[model samples]
Target: MRKTFTRTILSISFLALMLTASNGYAQQNNTNDEGAQHLVKWNVAALLLKNYSFQYEQAIGRKTSLALGLRFMPKSSMPFSSVLKNAIDDDQTWNSIKDFKTGNFSITPEFRYYFGESVFQGFYVAPFLRYARYNADLPFHYEYQQNATTTVKDKMDFNGGVDTFTGGVMIGAQWSLGKSISLDLWIAGPNYGFASGNISGKKTLNSMEQDELRKALDEDFKDLPLVKTKYTVDGNGAKIDFDGPWAGLRSGLSIGYRF
Candidate 1:
């Protein structure tokens, strides 16, 4: 709920900037621009990864623009299966992670400064803030004592999501195709941020089962970067808590239309 409220406020703030830029202020600079002061672009690079993303840019100054972008991917099979197996040294761990299904949604608001003769054409630098959320599901395995002389090995279904906020800078170049056509290349972007999440399974468990499940999590998720894995267990269910620093990179090839 807090995440939703934060995003809502950002959306409204962006809309206010849009209104101001598109009104008298935009016309005041129309003669100086003599070119398109607005552009909408589709990120083709993201499509290659089965993600859909789009951006809207509005010129707010002679050499500056403000843009808002959104990226989305529906929950499905994890990507790059081969890379996953090769990257992790543990075959058992790889086997377990191989079945994870994931998806994400993100929003980025950018402020750009163009160093070219025109606003939408030439090299530019942009500082941006991004808010992203990711959802995932995995089958977690464990062993528990079911009877005096018997041991049960089983897997429980786990599902949950995370929310993160980050800030970054990107450098890129844009070319005007003709009257209203454009091409934008996002060369490099790196961001750092904090993250928190809860992943859990909904099922009744005995004390012994819960204890064993907690031990399994400690072993399986120990490698998660920059964070300590936390486990919560009860008769109601089991949960994994995540809180840590996150780093990310962004790059894209986009096609745009100016108006």
Candidate 2:
């Protein structure tokens, strides 16, 4: 799981750099400066992965264009919820079965303007204002045996979900790739921290409930060591702020029909 997460981050960063390098080429080489003749092109692609997949893009113009993207993944993607449920459902791992599946999604749309002479070929920097949305739910199935009677039983299920939004500044570079395509790379973080809010299908677990669960597990299962899990969730009901520069990175190729 750690390896998978690390690979995802690395892949995103590498793609972003390649796109920016391509855009830099277009800026330094293109001699044509006629603003009226410059053209804008759009490209889009879909991502298919284990738990998270989505579509993203790159737009090229004379000096500015837009960046829009979206992604979907499940919080239960890594199986943390299963561990949590284990503490509540049974004392042993195989004694009781707990299953939860969640869905996560985000959308980003922004206006980005280049800094150099050309849009596609210029070495440009863009300051963007963007928004994101996240939603998730964990449906659980539990089975256990009564302590005193040794009778076994199972519960129907439980569900949990949350929603949030964030606004921030993103700085990126656009490097030109030949005459028709541009490579893009960027990093972004929130200004005043991130704000987020969410609703769960089942009763939500507060911070205290979660902490108690953790403490109980540590005391009861000290012999069985497990990695600690930490989460950084910020945002109000509609909007929030965040900390970090490389929130995400994206890359793609585009075709243009210049007039």
Candidate 3:
């Protein structure tokens, strides 16, 4: 999987560079340019989703530029609580997520080519590479058989994180907003890649309890689209390991200062 991901990234990056090199015809249409050589931008729309992001872009030539962006999300309650609860519709799943907390960090680098002969002007296509990490904590719930006829329900606290890398393209438009300011509208950008992660907890359990907990985990997440899952249960504790496809989107309004 690692090799595959690396290859995908190299392919996308090479394609972007090739396009930039082959765009010699655009050099003759440079009169449409009306922007500065450097820009600093903030995607304020991300504030609504609790994700703060910023970007710095530099014009490299008559119609191409390079940009890098960083995003950080402080630990907070998981967004869309009601929507997720209603979607799952399971008491056990609900119990685990009622107090769920999460945070994230990511970095993205992109190559942009403007259709109107300048950076941060008119329409543009951007091919980007993103690496993201997601941190989460929740209580895993399960049932344990105590004696001949007694059953106890309990929960184990689990915390862990996942990492992902993906490459994709975006199309957007930017317009100069006064002498030094610019407005960028990310029309739409969708990305796809692979992800793997582990979330585990410590709880001494007998063989019956371990089996029951394994079954509980399966029953809880069976509906999701995970490609594969591996559970480890031993004397001290248990762990849940899984890997699958990861997909994401990029679309927001940004305010920028050009100089």
On lDDT, the candidate that comes out on top is 1
Candidate 1, after superposition: displacement of residue 114 in Å?
1.1
Q: What is the Å distance of residue 204 in model 2 from its true position?
A: 17
Q: Which ranges of candidate 2 are over 4 A from the true structure?
A: 1-62, 70-99, 120-131, 140-156, 188-259
Clashes of each: 0, 25, 0
Candidate 1 or 2, higher TM-score? 1
Provide the lowest-lDDT 10-residue window in model 3: 23-32
Superior candidate under lDDT, 2 versus 3: 3
- What's model 3's TM-score? 0.79
Best by TM-score: 3
Between prediction 1 and prediction 2, the one with superior lDDT is: 1
Per-residue lDDT tens digits for candidate 3, residues 1-259, read 9999999989856854553443333344443235468999999999987899999999998889999999999988777887888899778778778788889999999999999745666679999999999888878877766788998897777788888888899998776645677777787889888888888888897787777777887776666673356778776777877688888999988899888
Better of 1 and 3 by TM-score: 3
Query: Each model's TM-score?
Result: 0.78, 0.45, 0.79
C-alpha lDDT of all candidate models, in order: 0.82, 0.43, 0.80
- Cα lDDT over the full model 1: 0.82
| Per-model RMSD to reference | 11.4, 9.9, 9.6
Two-way lDDT contest, 1 vs 3, winner:
1
